[model samples]
Target: MKQCWLDIRAAEGLKSVLCQEAIHRGFDAIVADDPADLAGLPPTVSRVLLPGKELPDAFGDADLVIVDPVQHGEPGRLAARHPGVRFGAHVDVTDADSLAVACASVTRDPVTVLRFADPTNIPLEIVLAAAADAHGLIVTTVERAADAPVFLGVLEHGPDGVMLAPSAPGEAGRLKDAVERRSPDLELTELTVTAITHAGMGERACVDTCTYLARDEGILVGSRAKALVLCVSETHPLPYMPTRPFRVNAGAIMSYTLADGEHTRYLSELRAGGTVLAVGADGRSRPVVVGRVKIETRPLLSIDAVAEGGEAVNVIVQDDWHVRILGPGGAVLNSTALQPGDRILGYLPRRERHVGYPIDELCYEQ
Candidate 1:
């Protein structure tokens, strides 16, 4: 992988710097001066934009970055120093320590969250948004703010469980009380809210635009963890939109979800336990399959994907109508009822070095 850095200053300068960083690695110099500059950086490399303001210490260790403080995410200690680099919507992720402390207390084996919290512990919202969108979590925003309450994302399921953004802050307490007052499965953690929006932010251009994007990508920001949150892109693409991905109760989100184009290509191989999220303005759907769909999250098919630890690696073992994924240790992680025409996660296990099933019509680099 060619690590790089981008500097977004003036539109003209941005184009040049983005091109440079896409090709090299260096310190603060990017400045988002215009739309052209903002669009200068290459879309491939992991992006890290400077907030042009306050940044936290967590970003200090980034390998490649793009500077565009005007970006969304947040301002912190690390961002302050890396002036010009733009890592907007991708900031503010569940710190590995927090996630470890949170999830380890729950999962059977209890892996260390820190291990997953590398600078690339990816925003939980982004992952979730992608998943939810895949599962057909359609978009129909309330015309009025007072419309029937919509679940922001996370919900209190049990102890050390995922949190959904409450419509009102006090609603968290209400939800907490409801869980404590009614259910008795596990302890209740605080409600967490994901920021996933793209309504005219960046490129939407209007409310219709925002809805269009969500209809296309479920929630803009999400993660690949057991649960996915749909929230706005923290350090959004540009212009800025307020999106939010809710923290789903672990296991609350079963099946799969898809956002945008690439994730939707393959709907046939999904097992019943799959989900397909659709969060885009074209909520009704146009259904244009642009690329081939591959089920492996840990994409080993492409050298580029492998180097980036792109997707989870899973193998396809079909037994007539069913598909089973054998873990590296030779155990079935999960199975689903998804059938042809259904959208499911591209199931990939950690052990098998499988390439991927190909879609006949799409333009796949593979």
Candidate 2:
């Protein structure tokens, strides 16, 4: 399980509120400038001291110590000098060299506190790289609640913990919830092609997600509620047109999409600012914001498929060669060359959903 900490050293007026909330949320510890500041804290919650001038004489009583490598030398040496004392080096995320040093220092000390003072200029890629580099604990401090998911979702395995400050009230709980949520992963099964037909001209939905998608990543859409087909995005380079790595020419407007595994939404209902899951060929998924949804009248091709379990599904997509699907062994198959009996990757919902959440109820969609 991931860990979380609360920094209340500089919290003047909101110190008590933040400390109590941190205890309520089961944080690992509360970091303060002086150990006396955490006197009233619950016994279950550990206390961490950020010694300024010098090491405290009661260091053995404190659970953790945070220090700066530049001012106090290496944290590992400090820990070695004072036996039984655990120390964590404080690092600024903006400094590349400092970030690298901090990540490397994790080999000597098991914990590193990565601080991000500038919320507007939070370097997400650097933070992710640092987190990947650290073999031990990588704790971060963000300025806002919105930045929580970014740090928690950037890599397959994100940071081990985060330090919530008192700057944002009532945000620690929400940040904890976001970090605790499991990363998205898709379960794809084989669907045999049943039929392909020309469905004349219709409005097709071209979903442009906020994140840049890879060639193997796309959206899942189909006609049936239980079964859905993986529609590869427009990231593949074509002889006729340039690649749009951020766009997925999903399907006809009425087609159903597996928005976030539990919930299904119509392709036509998708609009800017809506959320969608970008699925890769390996079945791993990540949430993406809808940047734009383009609807255009174009010739359509209807694809019918059925699984071995007797489940049948269909989708009408733009009759263009650029639109593709994932076949057996993760091979890319163009829609224009699809034939009967060709196996393609698809998904089956475990249970029905209501308003984007799972519920124990019967529901159907045509």
Candidate 3:
């Protein structure tokens, strides 16, 4: 199982139901309910009150990002910016389909999410190789908004350390004094932040994907940011991430990208007899670009064709790193770094064969 950054959203009761579902399904939980607390949070399962502004600069790694439209106080425009994070705004209490669609929409972007999961429900620290989630902790003395100066006061207790000042006046002075007081034995650096949220020392509803050892195998969905695949060496009767948290290239293969050499979403067990395909699949019929490859750019575009609903009539195979069809498949393909301006075009697919345009003859923008 993977360690998940579960963002509990109240967009129509996702928060009300998310925690209970995770618990009933037996997951570690981290509850951050207030919006103010989320100001400088690192990725963790938190209930947020979205004011429609973007998440703070201090927000850290997160696979799942949920938003409740009510929290935003208007149309949920916040969903557009974080294309990589799964999305859902509260429509009503019975809107499971809408929630699922929102999750799918955001996770379809091209990026591999790191993961860790545990089958037995254990501590989050068990699977950390290094700092997988947090880069640094944002600590404060004041537990409430009124406590901002308290954070400054507490800092004074620490061992003498480097000082940083914000452009703001009162905040700068108080924080400096706090550090001088509680200074510990270790080095402490002072940074100014209006607020911060953290990974509470409690149940984390989800984990980084590798946190669990599973015996079974099934489709791993990157449909949600926090989605993960747990390998206990035995398959469980249910789905890997039942929440439908992320999106995959297809309904079958969940996807991920390489980060610092560890596998995520889908684990690379290195078992024998598996062929790693290098084809970069696309949704177009025109040749795709491989900016990191032999050429600088190439066109491999495809159109979504459906007899009825939204489904592609054909698929595109591009030679570019960003064939524009990025999704779950770092598992199937390997990446080769390209010098600037190098690119390639492998193949392209089309919705309907134009009377004059064969998949081979069609040309698209690079």
Q: Which residues of candidate 3, in runs, are more than 4 Å off?
A: 4-33, 39-65, 69-366
Summing lDDT over every window of 10 consecutive residues in candidate 2, give the lowest-scoring window. Answer: 117-126
- Candidate 1's residue-wise lDDT over 69-109, tens digit each? 12432223334666743232222224644443323222221
TM-score, model 3 to reference: 0.17
Error of 2 at 186 (Å): 2.3
C-alpha RMSD values across all candidates: 25.1, 4.6, 26.7
Candidate 1 wrongly placed segments (more than 4 Å): 1-260, 264-275, 279-281, 284-358, 361-366
Backbone Cα, N, C clashes tallied per candidate: 137, 0, 93
Model 1 clash count equals 137
Leading candidate by lDDT = 2
Report lDDT (CA) for all predictions: 0.25, 0.79, 0.25
Residue pair clashes in candidate 2: none
Output the TM-score of candidate 1.
Answer: 0.16
The predicted structure with the larger lDDT, 2 or 3, is 2
